[model samples]
Target chain A: MAAARSDRAPRRPTISDVARRAGVSTGTVSRYLNGGHWVSAESSKLITRAIRETGYVANSTARQLRTGRSGTVAFVVDEAPARFFEDPNFEALVVAVGDALAARDRSMVLLLAGDAQSAARAETFLVTSGVDGAVTASAHPEHQLFERIQAAGIPLVNVGSPTGLEDRIAFVAADEREGARLMAEHLIAQGARRIAVIAGPAHSPGGTLRPDAFTAAVDASASEGAAPVVIGLRHGDYTVESGRAAARTLLAEHPEIDGIFAANDQMARGAIDALREDGRSVPEDVLVGGFDDSAFAGTEVPLLTTVRQDFGRIAEELVDALDKQIDAGVRTNVIVPVQLVVRDSTVRPGS
Target chain B: MAAARSDRAPRRPTISDVARRAGVSTGTVSRYLNGGHWVSAESSKLITRAIRETGYVANSTARQLRTGRSGTVAFVVDEAPARFFEDPNFEALVVAVGDALAARDRSMVLLLAGDAQSAARAETFLVTSGVDGAVTASAHPEHQLFERIQAAGIPLVNVGSPTGLEDRIAFVAADEREGARLMAEHLIAQGARRIAVIAGPAHSPGGTLRPDAFTAAVDASASEGAAPVVIGLRHGDYTVESGRAAARTLLAEHPEIDGIFAANDQMARGAIDALREDGRSVPEDVLVGGFDDSAFAGTEVPLLTTVRQDFGRIAEELVDALDKQIDAGVRTNVIVPVQLVVRDSTVRPGS
Candidate 1:
């Protein structure tokens, strides 16, 4: 009786928490709670159950009063280990965004919305937490929470241009296609024929964009009819160990490849190591190029010749977009430029 | 009169804005607004005037009844750009703290409290903001805001063992002195004498403890009254650029120095560049050792010999302590051990 009483005391539940618990999306829950004539009977029943379970009693008096906005901007990302933080490219991008937000006197909230549970929690929190806006930097395309967030009428600025959501939302992202073209052009100019491209995870927007751009550039280049014998287009999970494994596979399967274009720096370094193990000298026998000219790109033995994204600028643009959306209700799509950083991995000094 | 009433509808005044108008500390203004009971009548009067002038009201009834804890922890740091995000050391530490807090459904707030104004703002926010706790990671000994946070009875955790506040608070820190001793002993065993030390900012507790330990180790290793010459002690701001400057200054001051001990990996790499510039070979002419075996430590041209602090572990310890403080009301002091990583910078292949 005591447990039941404690649970039943909160009679009026918050619409957002209900949305989270129901797994029916914030929009459905909000619509039902607000009695928006559009909510289906089934959705309303689910919302009612979620509310009863959460036991979130809404203060009717406070609900009637207008609450002023909190000048906070939440930046949600996959704060999982061994991926974003360990990768310099991701770190740089985050810092850039943080810097941009700071300049605008907006407090940035970092939410590690990694798994489905965390993502759902994050979505509910954002919808109800009273932040003015949000910036979603999830590299994974299948993160469904963003759609829910958009439907809930919260202002958002996505960091990476994820597919399926591109038609509906605006995002600030690095020009991977241009970056890949630069990498391919550099390798081609260096007299590389047999080019192998190591792609990022197949699902991510960056993963597909880079490889696509590389193939398109090869098709358009003067070496016209003779496209680089695309040998062993292996994939890695954007980790050093995964890169090492991908390198091993590429080497074993396509031993004749003279040039390797890794979608990111870590894989490029791994490719270089595998080539060295196979007794092929870098920039002499097999040239290499990687994307996201991370700090490690310069530190590797042969010095990775890779594409550089202005992470700080990208972040700044993102912040600007978020701020505009939050203040003026205007969504923006920003394209950050990338360039090729020439280094020892592609060009032999003596040669 | 109706038009004037409509025009007088106010914008929310922030703590900083109140402080600027009141001519008092933000903490004083916050305390006055919160009915802290500790603030004097004069302070209250000033705060009231500022509030009235700015058309600001505490909205005390709403604040007390609603606005449940923000569920955020502010991770305050001293420097704005000392590789806080770039270096995996601090990033890992933050992640650990974030992970711990997130498990308990709390958010980690990153506060880059680099200067006096920001520090004051942080103090005021710590006290008045709905956050349950704070974790400060600055090396500044006279951090007034850190002191204020402690005074306000806010549960605090320092990342490094902060000076002056060590007794009244709990901290999770790297065993810097022990690490320094290990490095010194290893260098001594390698026959390095006339060692010049490139230390972090001398004002910092880490700076004092590390160099003191190194000196004590050298003295213990020496025969009675036969101490090796310790020359060219230079200070750095714990950045690669500062390290480069210090390395240049140290070499110019003591050309006979056989080894270089840098307080951080950035400084050690700078020392390596300085050695090469001065036509001196590392390990042969001048052995190099650094603290905090960062990723760059392994990538350094000669692979830096350094003390490796498990930053990830330290981060875990910090977050753990914060959790205890937040949940169980228990305070703990944890000192994570460090290891000596022997690399080509100090140990030649033949030697």
Candidate 2:
């Protein structure tokens, strides 16, 4: 059989045909076409090849003109550059989102909104850099960034719960509270009593919600006549150094804590390092749990026990929501479920 | 003095005025404007704010037409995505290149040219992606990718030696041979006699040039009546795992090896890990030196001693070369010097 020979007619290939070529669900294809978020790499590659082979075009120039849309989606990261590069979680998401967008045949312009100047530049980039819509991540809740972006008449999608614009804007998030609760329960079941919580930034969703759920879980367990209780709570900026510092501080202040729940994996790793320096063993001495099972979690010497956010599903939902909003002037809010991955960090040695 | 309020006449500010405001050399500003590299972050931020405050524009739309520019540059990386993310060197270049470009008020569109399909896509991106010029990094020499881009009449400035069509193209390279020479001298001076070379992919500029230069240095040092000798050679895929695997094989084959010269930092780290597992002490039992003095080099436990490639200078030269070629049809080839950074890895512990 000939490997390549498909030039039947000059007519354009419809998205449905492209979807058939990719062998993915039509809904997935729609998500891909609209906001470039949820499409898997394999399907995207196949769809891309199929489109190239068939010369698929989304619409005529006239329709594009009528829509007044540019073929660009702004990938807005509202965290400082250091945080952007320091956390593997952000890099993983960036790669995932970029791939998803590429599959949809839409170009993405990355904009950093970390400081006032950078934020202003990002706003300028959105308005003057031909960006039609934006997908924001880790924006400060008090900054009114999303409101400003929406006010610019551009569609927006937030990675987590929108800062304060939930009713009008769209968002996609993992179940952070449930993830935290599961982690607490896992530690309790593993015989952890005096637990410590290393939380994220105070106003950020993970910082506030994850710690709240963890505390509630501890209180509920104690109410049910369980032995475990929250002994201390310290905050970290979702960084390894912050986690390490917080752990050192907790160890200095509350040495009786038997379990540590870090809001993110970086902090958990940091806490583990702090424990080792202080001549303590993980799980055996103080059980540790973290959230956001990042790329490097499994690579660690003692593999991390963490809450897993299915980035693929999040990307899919984010793309779908953005696509629907951009195309039909609608808003959607969806929370993908999270899972607890038990690894070396939580399990007792030799168990 | 007032911190704000500068609303002068509607006429656009000039580059000279912007340069003067930033207190940087005129050459630096010109280099920045032509292609987005070489300008340091501190100066770029100042220049950007100055331009913003003054509402500067390069020229009229009619002049822009005469120049046939899109204000967009294609930052082409001719490697697989995994390779792109794995090596810290690539990311450093990306951030540096992006910063360099942004300072000049030019946008960069990233394109990958790893496989045949991606190569085709890159070519298409150069022609159809509104790319005015290209700055290619780590492209395979045999691919004739530069030829195709030049044939497409798009101006280009390569990050290293261009594939085959060298005479017509512009390029900027770190002094690879000199860098290798210095590292070899450093290792030899540290009392290493039996050295093993963990090389990169053979055809890459670093893979070929660094090994050749290192071997030459070893031979030249011998001619100068030195004691160091080449013990073995192994190739790695510029990954930590590859370096570890190569080191394992080298140790099995040549047990007498006393020094390691990995072509890159990733492989160097891998070799270090392999050494630890083999119950060998670094510097005391075996000395190691790496190249690229990557962002993580100082962060490593032993603090890697390696050849430092000035990414900022490379970025600047690359931009200048491309700008010259694109603006005046001139071809430039310049080699910026590299440096040897001594650290914990090579130094004797007691010393």
Candidate 3:
């Protein structure tokens, strides 16, 4: 189609030229390009054909100016360069978000929120940088800049819910409770009586969700007078170091614990490290499971059993929802699903 | 200085309002603001005072159009997300480049040369997307695109030298040969008699330089009849997995080796894992060093002793060079220095 149009114009025809040729406004052409509006099918066909015929390349800057949009989305993550690299979810989430943004011809700007100064700077950019929307990973509940973003009228999407913001703002996150329940059920089915969990920071939304849900699931599954032992809960900052520290504490507190669940992959890797240091054979001595089916899950020596949250799919939905709001002034609430990924970490002996 | 001139129009003001009040043309005002390029210094000072009085913000885009120059620079890197995140040199380089660009009131656009398709698309944008100049990484050599950029009159600055393109292009890079020599000398000083090397992919320019220089340095250090045994050389793709696989093979083939040098940090990490898996304690049985003092180097149990390339400083120089070319039409070469970061990995027992 583009080739056929190439012969008619020396240069690519622009949307404004098409609008002039079709006797329609530039906004109408823009509406046609960003689908899901009220444009008639015939009008849509005409616009698409015109775009093909002229090989029209949308002037992103002009379109942004006319619509008071930047055609850009910003994403912020809690960052320590080392932690960011080691976290398997970080790579997956960024790739997913980048892919989603590229599909909509929108660029994704990354903001690494680490210190107070950088956070404030990122907030200023988020509000004033002309981005249409934002996606943030609220690792800590008390992040000040995220609050500023919430108040700035930009459509903010959360990869995981932030404390205090969940009730006031819309978010798209994994079903943490269901995923935890699956982990608990798997342990019970494998005849593991004593279960311990290495959780993330106590205040984080995700950290709180998995442990509480797992505890409740365990409580409900036990028969009268034969309840399974809840060994211990240890906290980590979703880093290998913190994970390793938590694992040592958990092991010391409950040496009889037969099953372990870590909230993320880095922590899970730390757990593996601790187990090795303590001379405990994986799956034979203790079954382990982790959250976030990151890229390294399959690559681990004893492959990590994890909860899979399709970050790319969620990212695509987030962009679609934001684009809808930008183009048609519509709003949406989306909930992404999570699934348990069983691997070498969770399998019992002889199973 | 900005507050000195208020409410009064000095001979030639910095802005149009100032120019109007001072009874001068806007062109004269612009020339004055551009540091008396075509105006007297007296006129420039008067214009500055007028600008101070009016509190005028320079419209960079408008100024760019008027001057037929874009206040923007392009930074091109390989599209590998893992490399982008894990390579400390790349991160430091970008931050430094950003600082330099910001200092000149310009913005840096990140261009990804991921694959042939994306590379082609990015090349099209880099040449025609209003960027003033470009800083390209030689690691991902796209010679054809480099030639096209040169033809487009875009001042090109390369990070490293590549085949067929050296001497023609301006470049800023660390002294790879010197860094390799220092690393080899350090290993020799630590009394390592048998050294096995894990080299990066053979295709990259740095890969060839580092290994060749290290071998020469090692040869030079050896006295008559006391040359250290060159155990083995294995190649990796500068990835952690590749490093691990290569390390495993190197260890299997050369069990007597007392020293190891990885071409980069990612490969060094793999060697660490391989050595640990084989029950060889680092710094006691084997001494190891890596290139690129990346974040991973610090995160390890015993931090890696490696070559520290001042990527940020180099990036600053690259941007400064590009700006000089743009503002004064000066072209020059910049050579940044590299340092050896000593850590626990290369330290021998007792010594």
What are the models' TM-scores? 0.69, 0.74, 0.65
- Write model 2 residue lDDT over A71-168, tens digit each, in one string: 55667887755467677877777667756765665555455556544554454344322345788898885555675566445679988876456687
Q: Write the per-residue lDDT of candidate 3 for residues A1-351, one digit (tens) a residue.
A: 444632212232456767766667778877654431566546645654554343343332334546645455667775643455557677778778877766555456566655443454454344323356777775454555556565445567677765565676556777888988998888777667888888888757547898888888987895444576567988888888888898899999888878888888888888989988999978888888888887778897799888888887788877776666566656566777888888887786578
Ranking by DockQ: 2, 3, 1
Compared with the true structure, model 1 gives a TM-score of: 0.69
Q: Could you tell which candidate, 1 or 3, scores higher by TM-score? A: 1
TM-score of chain A of each: 0.77, 0.79, 0.78
Candidate scoring better on TM-score of 1 and 2: 2
Best by lDDT: 2
lDDT, model 3, position B13: 14
Tens-digit per-residue lDDT, B223-300, candidate 1? 334355567688887777777888888878777789888888887888888888889999888889998887777885
**Candidate maximizing TM-score:** 2
List, for all models, the DockQ compared with the true complex: 0.04, 0.08, 0.07
Error of 1 at B245 (Å): 4.0
Better of 1 and 2 by DockQ: 2
Candidate 1 overall lDDT versus native = 0.68
Candidate 2 local lDDT, residue A119: 53
